[model samples]
Target: MEKNKKVVILNILLVGTIILNLFIFTSRMRFFPWFIEDAWGYLGVFLTAPILIGIYFMLRHFHKQQLVTSTNKVIPLFVAATSLIIVFMPTTDFLNIVAIVINAASVFLAANFLFNQNGGKNNYGFSRLKNQS
Candidate 1:
């Protein structure tokens, strides 16, 4: 597959996995009350493993393809950091909502960067900078 197309697909998969992680984390109590009541901490680890693995492999792929721009490199770090925070923090409704919003925003930023046509360039309001001599 073409590189751009592969990146797009990977981004899609990344976003989907993030959403799934959020859903499972937020609703684990309702969906698996027995498991949560018995092993809440382990549940966090179980839920987080896939996301961390996905981020690791995605970063590896980007690095292998020489697509590791500053912006793209930081995107996965932000995703992983926020995900870890969500997993390790004390679980409260407010905290969960806040974490979800932060995670979603980071994911949105990642998607924007991955899908940009200029290859993640930060123009800083100078749209014509690259074209200028």
Candidate 2:
């Protein structure tokens, strides 16, 4: 995907994940009187996390001008696999545990990727361009 398009997709995924988290939190905490409990609601919450991780890697790939390492790419696959397992067997608590572990590993890989690329510095900011001498 093109850089600009990938950036846009990443932003959308990020926003969606935030919204999903809010809904889940509110539903669990009974903070929102208008919160409707439904099967689709939980499905959306569960699916957004993996999608966000996948988009992060995709954007990273575009930013670096190279494909992410094979191991890194597998994070999304693991997320998807766990998601499928949960979908097939939503009542199984063990599947949720597996999914959590997979997501945690993906997060670790993403952090490592970012830190390595930026030499352990915060590279997610804007800076004024130097004036031509």
Top TM-score: which candidate number?
Answer: 1
lDDT of each residue in 1-133, candidate 1, tens digit only:
8776776766666666666555555553555543244325435545555665676577667767776455555555565666676667767767666766766776686677657735545767556546766
Question: For candidate 2, lDDT tens digit of each residue in 1-133?
Answer: 6554554455455444444443543442234674545434446646665675676567557547653445544444455555555556654446545544555555566555533443333455433353436
lDDT of all the models against the reference? 0.61, 0.50
Instruction: Determine which window of 10 residues in candidate 1 has minimal summed lDDT.
Output: 33-42
lDDT leader: 1
Candidate 2 lDDT: 0.50
**How does residue 27 of candidate 1 score in lDDT?**
55
As for candidate 1, its clashing pairs are none
Task: Write down the worst ten-residue block by lDDT for model 2.
Answer: 21-30
